[model samples]
Structure formats: structure tokens, C-alpha cells
Target: MSSSVTSPERKKIHPHKFTLWVAMGSIVMMFAGLTSAYVVKKSQSNWLEFPLPKVFWYSTAAILVSSLTIHLALKAFKARQMGRYKNLLTVTVVLGLLFSVLQWMGFGHLQQSGVQLFGVGSNPAASFLGIITGLHVLHVLGGVIALLVIFFRAFSSSRKTYSPVSIEIVSTYWHFVDILWIYLFIFLSVV
Candidate 1:
């Protein structure tokens, strides 16, 4: 008789992983279509030229900070440092909220700066900017909700036994959203 310890074949995937991947892929496609349209429409005629809002730079910096905080939180979770993980998660959540508020203020600043979005079919560029940022804001709001869910979950006793996969997934999604915003900001700024 052959005395060999055979390892079980690894299962292909859990259902949750499939769902997460599908969601991520959908988000990628949505942003890709938006950016492509932005590029195409920007090349056309009669686009208004206005100064980009100063608040945008502040919002970018806030998002970068938030990304770092979430990364630290992930690392802490992996290391089993529950205290540090909680602290970092709190900071990341705060930063995400701050980014949203800054983006809102940026829109207000644009209005105050006499950058009209739409009037008499004028300022097409401003209108596009509003639309793109508005859509981005909606996505960011979703991210904030995701973060809140993660935050509340961390407080539950069951959370101690839960795998860090959900937290990691949220971090990945948040970072993707942040990078997308940065790309859109740069694209709008230059064009």
C-alpha cells in the first residue's frame, strides 16, 4: 500500500469572491466609459476655458492621506494589532468624509469664481466638469458608506473572528476610487 498523504484539491473560488470581482469590474467599466467620453467631448469646439478650483488641490491631498491611512489600517489588521487597526480605521473614515466635504466646497468655489456651469448653451466645459465631478461624488459617497459598514463591523465581537478579506476588499475599492478622482482632476485641469 502506498502511504502518501494526498492534499485535497483547492476549490475554484468562494461565491463572495466572485461577487466582489464582478462589482470591481463593473466600476472599472463605468469609469472607463466616463473618461473616454470626457476625452472625446473635450476635443470639440466652444468649450469654456476657466481656472480649476483651488479647493481641488486640497481635496486631492486629503484623498492621498486617506489612502495612506487605509493602507496602514490594512497592515495593522494583518499584523493582528487590533488597537492600531481601530485607530487607523477611524482616521481613514474621517479622511474619507473630509474629502467629500472638500469636493463639495470645491464646487461652491467654482460657482463663486464666476465659472458658470450652463447658461444659454454656453460653457460646455463647465457643464461637463459638473457632470463628471457629480458622478465621481456619487461614487465617493458609496465608498464612504462602505467604510462606515466596515467601521461598525469592527465593533462587533464576531468581527474578531471575521477574516480581514472584507476590510481588504473595501480598501482596494477605496483606493481605486481615489485614483480615479485624481485622474479625472488632472484630465479636467489640463483640458
Candidate 2:
């Protein structure tokens, strides 16, 4: 043979999953930029540092438990345990909502403690905290919405679409948000 060429095969990821990963990467970049700015701003004047509210811990616990429930839900889906999966998914959705509510309460605590979130007398530090945590809560709400879709689908008597990939994707996104919150909590606590 005069010449021989060989190409290695590439593994493929599901388009939906690939899209989710890309979106997640973008989210990471956005948070990274925001947190970086936070650190830099901290060095400047008029940056008031306040204690993170105790409710944040409760929210963290809620999200962590939600992550567990989502993980279990995915497992149940894979095992064809529809009842368990549906129950676990319901718990995950409730926990997600609880996390969001706790986060709002945490902000209330901050406001009560004289940390103005925004407006004429707001401190930059408190403003940043509000922006970052609020964005995270929005992401959690998005996950909750996704879970609700799956939850409703699971219970639909008209059509039963038991797509494991869909469940897996939702589970992955839920875990991602959960971990992101943990990272943000630690970052806020330390720096």
C-alpha cells in the first residue's frame, strides 16, 4: 500500500446533554466573573461585610437533600421502579421549592440586619450578595420547573413517556445546581 490513513472514532454525547453542558459552562464563566469582581471590589472602599444569614445553612441542607432525592429518582427510573421514581421526584421538587423559599428568607434576614439590597442607601457588598444569591435561586427555580414537567409527565394517564435520558438530564442539572450552591455558600462564607 502506498499510503494508509486511520481516524479514531469519537464518542458521542446526547444533543440535549451536550447543550446542557454548554449552558452549564457558560453559567460557570458568568459566576466566575461575578465572584472575581466581588473579590476585587472587596478591596475597595465602602464595601460592607455582613454575616451570612443562618437560613442559608437550612437552604443548603434543603438543596443537598434535593440532590439526593433527584439521584434516587434517577436510579428508580433506571430500575423501572416508576412509583419510587415518581415519589422521589416529587420530594425533589418540594425540596427545591423549599430551598428557594429559604433563600428568600435569608435575604430578609440580611435586610433586617441593615443590609440594604439595592436603592439609594444600598452597600455594594450587599448588592453583590443579592445579585449572586438571587441568580442562584433563579437557577434552582428553573430546575424546579424542569422537575415539574417530568413530574406531570410521570403521572399523565393519557401518555406515558418513560424516557430515562430525560430523567437523567434533569437529575444532572439538579445536582449541578446543588453543587453550585454549596460552592457559593463556602465562597461567601470564606471570602
Candidate 3:
């Protein structure tokens, strides 16, 4: 048999990884649609603009730090430093929770200032801000759940049986959400 028959021309990508990439691509498209609509909607005279709350600034800092922590956690996992990995995972969860809380506080701030999400007085801009950020929060919550599963598994009886696939998948998704939040934060901040 020829060597070409015995071996493929190129190694195949992992299916799970390929699926993740597809999902991420879809997410990018969805957000692009949203922001584009926002841009178009903002041109109307009814669009309302307001200063984003300072808590959002604080939340952005927290989320950025969380992304760094998750990167370190992945490294620790690869090093087989179970203790460090667990600790880092816990920290990431805390940070994720803090980010969501801060986002909720931002909503409260907007409401207190009379920026309603939906009403006769609510403008498209305020609605877009609320809907976009709210969707991002839900995605962040999903990431937090995945982190918790990984965190618990790290301490379970099967701790000796390390599966990099699950960890890697979760980490990839977590990083995606972090990047998504950063983009949304910048987008909302600008227009």
C-alpha cells in the first residue's frame, strides 16, 4: 500500500473543537446583527444616550481579571497542579458572579435614572443596551455553571482520571464569554 493510502494528508480537527468554533461564529454573527441594528436605530431622533454607570467600569475590570485567572487555571491544569487549578477555578467563579452582580447593579442604576427597558417613554437605545447586556449576562451564567462542574470534578473521587477534553472545552467557552463581554462593554460604551 502506498504511504498516502495508509495516512491522511492532514490531521483532522477534533469534532468538539470544530463544533465550538462553529458556535462561536454563530454568536459573533448574532452580536454583529444586534450592534448593526443599534447603529441604524441610533440615527433616529428618538434615540436616547446616557452615561454608563461607574459600576460597569468596575465590572469590566473584574471580568478582564477573571479572563487572566482562567488562563492561569488552564496552565495549572496542564501542569497537573490540582490544588492550584481548583483554587483558580474557584476564583474564576467568584469573579464571574461579581461581573453578573455588577451588571445587574448597572441596570438598577439605569432604572433609577428613569431609563426603562420597555415602555411608552423607553427609547430604542436604552432597550438595546438592556437587551444586549442581558443576553450577555445569561451567557456568562452558563459559563459559570460549566466552571462549577469542572471545579467540583477536580475534587471528586475521579480526580485521578483527568480528561483534558472537558476542561479544555469549558475553558474555551469561558474565554469566549470573556472576550464577548469585553467587546460588548466597548460597544455599549462607544455608541
Best candidate according to TM-score: 2
Q: In candidate 1, residue 118 scores what lDDT?
A: 63
Off by over 4 Å in 3: 1-9
| Candidate 3 RMSD to the real structure | 2.0
lDDT of 2 by residue, 1-191 (tens): 58877788888999999999999999999999999999999998888978999999999999999999999999998888999998999999999999999999999998898889999899989999999999999999999999999999999889676678889889999999998999999999999
TM per candidate comes to 0.86, 0.94, 0.92
Best by lDDT: 2
Which ranges in model 2 have alpha carbons more than 4 Å from their true place? 1-10
Estimate, for each residue in 98-141, the C-alpha lDDT of model 3 and write its tens digit.
Answer: 99999999999999999987777887988999889998998889
Instruction: Give all candidates' CA lDDT scores.
Output: 0.84, 0.93, 0.89
lDDT of 1 by residue, 64-148 (tens): 9999999999999999998898899999889888888998898888888888766764477788788788888888888889899
| lDDT at position 28, candidate 1 | 73
Measured with C-alpha atoms, the lDDT of residue 24 in candidate 2 is 94
- What's the TM for model 3? 0.92
**Candidate 3 — which pairs collide?**
none
Clashing pairs in 1: none
CA-RMSD of model 2: 2.4
- Residue 178: error of model 1 in Å? 1.5
